[model samples]
Target: MLMGEFWGLGVRFRVSAMENCWDFLQWLGPDASTCVFASLDDPSDLVRASAVSRSWRRFVIANGFSRSLCRRICPEVSNFTRAVEVSSSAMNQEVGSSTAVEWESLVREHRIYSYLCRCLVSPEGSSDCIDRCIGASSTDNFPDESIENTLEPSDRVYMRPSYWSSGGEADPQVPESLIYRLGSDLCVVNEIKIQPFKAFFQHGDPIYSVKFVRFRMGNSKLPLRSENYVTDENEGQAAADDNFVWTYISPEFPMLQESVLQSFKLPRPVLCIGGVVKIELLGRVQKQAMDGLYYICVSHVQVLGRPLSPKLALDTSEASGASVLKYFPVDSSSVAPNGASRDDEAREPSRWHAFAATLRHLRAGGAWNQAILNTLLRPVQFAEEDDDSDEEEPYA
Candidate 1:
């Protein structure tokens, strides 16, 4: 995907220049070009097609095809107000020499969105995004067995309790939720894995597993100030739900009373903006022998997804959960810097830009729906049709 940065600036396309590559913009005009390019189904194809020719690349940028493609794959991307890519001063001087600076901004958008589309749909690998435990609904032994322990991947380690324990509750229906902060501002989540803890030290090795569990992903309304950070040391100081704006809520999943880690793959990959995850543990199925009260315990939890970082960042300055995508493209001599690239610096947008944006909007309505229909007609790797009915319950 790093090569995408160069493709956005037409770097890779320079050597492959040809006189006649269908030259759609010249032969058929903008409307026909819209229907043809917007019809491209794959994000990778959309990016590579830009390298066909200079007109083709300009048409892709001016139309915001990359953005349209992304929004089609992941609807949450539509929430972004706009995308910005910062360029260096040397690039600014280059843009200063050009009369049409708006075109440069569009090129930046082309690169940024191509990268985003790749991250959202065709992620390469998995990583847990949990930065730290924000808080837990309850804790039986505070620091000894707290939500922080869930961050540890192992169920047992170095004579320490490597799990989180909930305070005993009289009613099994009482739900408990754990809050966590993902290190990045945005993460594309595919699945969440949870491991129930087996108290090997205790007699009979009881496993404290919840009967059902659910998940919520969102962002906090305000920046997490250090003074208000929640931790195992802060007893009963969990972050409240009122502080977040949840964008995705998963269906409740039944849990097994076993020590093995269980995976709950989402129906579809979700774009987690603002990077906050709330794991809701519902329906306690285990009881502490001494107190004879219901308790929920978890050994490990993982939100498996790709977190775009280093260059890509979110602008949290706006309301929480509504983060705008920001891309920092490594500026070449051709890139444009802020003041020089600002659209206001240019005269009224050329008809090509205006018509292209309009065409993208129209094509998005129909062509995207057609693409979705075609996608549904075939098998998708992300979606599976399996039910838990065939699995046997673990012996408690």
Candidate 2:
């Protein structure tokens, strides 16, 4: 009788174990698959999960798992799906079947958005200097001061003393504008830093400080090859300002009244298709002693972003045609009697006077013309020049 009882107990245990296994399988249905995938953070992991089995791939594609992951990573790309759908539909009418077109479009969006997400989250593998500043603009600049000076990197208190300034006039309502052109047609701007200049030599307090600053990204009506600078004809006029139509406007940020570098990060990554950024100094809190007018000054300005390259290697042959204005400061002590660097006596002019003479030489060859010079000298304006009806292409 004891032996019979042991056999019955063994049978009961086996049945129970089988039932438990069955129950666990039931728990892993479509709903459970979704729940598991939803918990995953990486889009690449989700793609790998889809390849595990036919059922998982179906679940990922049917429920749009990749798309959901993209939305979660970059909420700003919410419209990407609708835009892709429209584009896919238009393409479907051309050749492929509707189902194939839809599938292809979904895959494309997942790939593009996934790449963008990686760019935002991943550590920067390398840092290559992207020369995008085609030109610069300012509202008012002091004589002997150049906006190009702000692009240089320095450790001095006044990195580049040659700064753009609002004229010696106090008007809180009139804001100063500084515009920078991205040499490329489009770039992904990540960060911008501005260092306000302080006149330590002043008596009562440091004058020419910026109190408030804002930013705007927009498209330019002019061709990309054209120099992006204010001309003498449009100086202090609204027409120059009208040339650029702002697409994305940033919120106003308060600036510290010191010479320290201030950084402003975009709320989210922005696709700056317009290839131009305009920095607007809304409040001038200090006045200059010599001029007795309100002035805002900046020692340096920097734009940190990635340039888009379709090809593996960028063709820079055309880049020569693009006018790039850069300044290199010369150490007076290193100069030889004949005005050359110690190492290379055949070096180009390092002094301001010699540099100006070289610019004149370049201008004579029609390489640097009046428009380019005016852009370097005057402030950009904001008025409509002509009634040419050219509309910007919609973002895809």
Q: Specify the highest-lDDT model's number.
A: 1
Q: What's the true lDDT of residue 24 in model 2?
A: 24
Candidate 1 displacement at residue 208 in angstroms: 1.6
Candidate 1 lDDT tens digits, 1-396: 343453454433344434444444565678976887787657877767675666767788889888998887777787788887655532563455365666666766777888788778764888777765678888888666767677667776544457889889989999999898776667898899999999988889999998888999878787665334444235434378888878788998998889989999988888887778999999989888898999999989989988765346667575444467776443222334332221111111122222332333343345556555444333212221222232111110
For model 2 the local lDDT of residue 144 reads 31
C-alpha RMSD values across all candidates: 20.1, 16.0
Residues 1-396 of candidate 2: C-alpha lDDT, one tens digit per residue = 343353344345445756665432134677765676676667556555555444545566667766576567644334221322122133444367888766765555544444444544545532212232333344464233445445545323122244555565567556777777653334567777888876655686484666778887755555443233333222222225677656567888888887777888877666454457888887778867676677777767777776432210111113333211111122323223332111111211223322442443354446777777655534322231222333221111
Q: How close is candidate 1 to the true structure, as a TM-score?
A: 0.70
Q: Please list the C-alpha lDDT of all candidates, in the order they appear.
A: 0.69, 0.51
Deviation (Å) of 64 in candidate 1: 1.9
TM-score of each: 0.70, 0.58
Backbone clashes in model 1, listed as residue pairs: none
Question: Which portions of model 1 show Cα errors greater than 4 Å?
Answer: 1-33, 89-99, 121-123, 201-203, 236-238, 319-322, 331-396
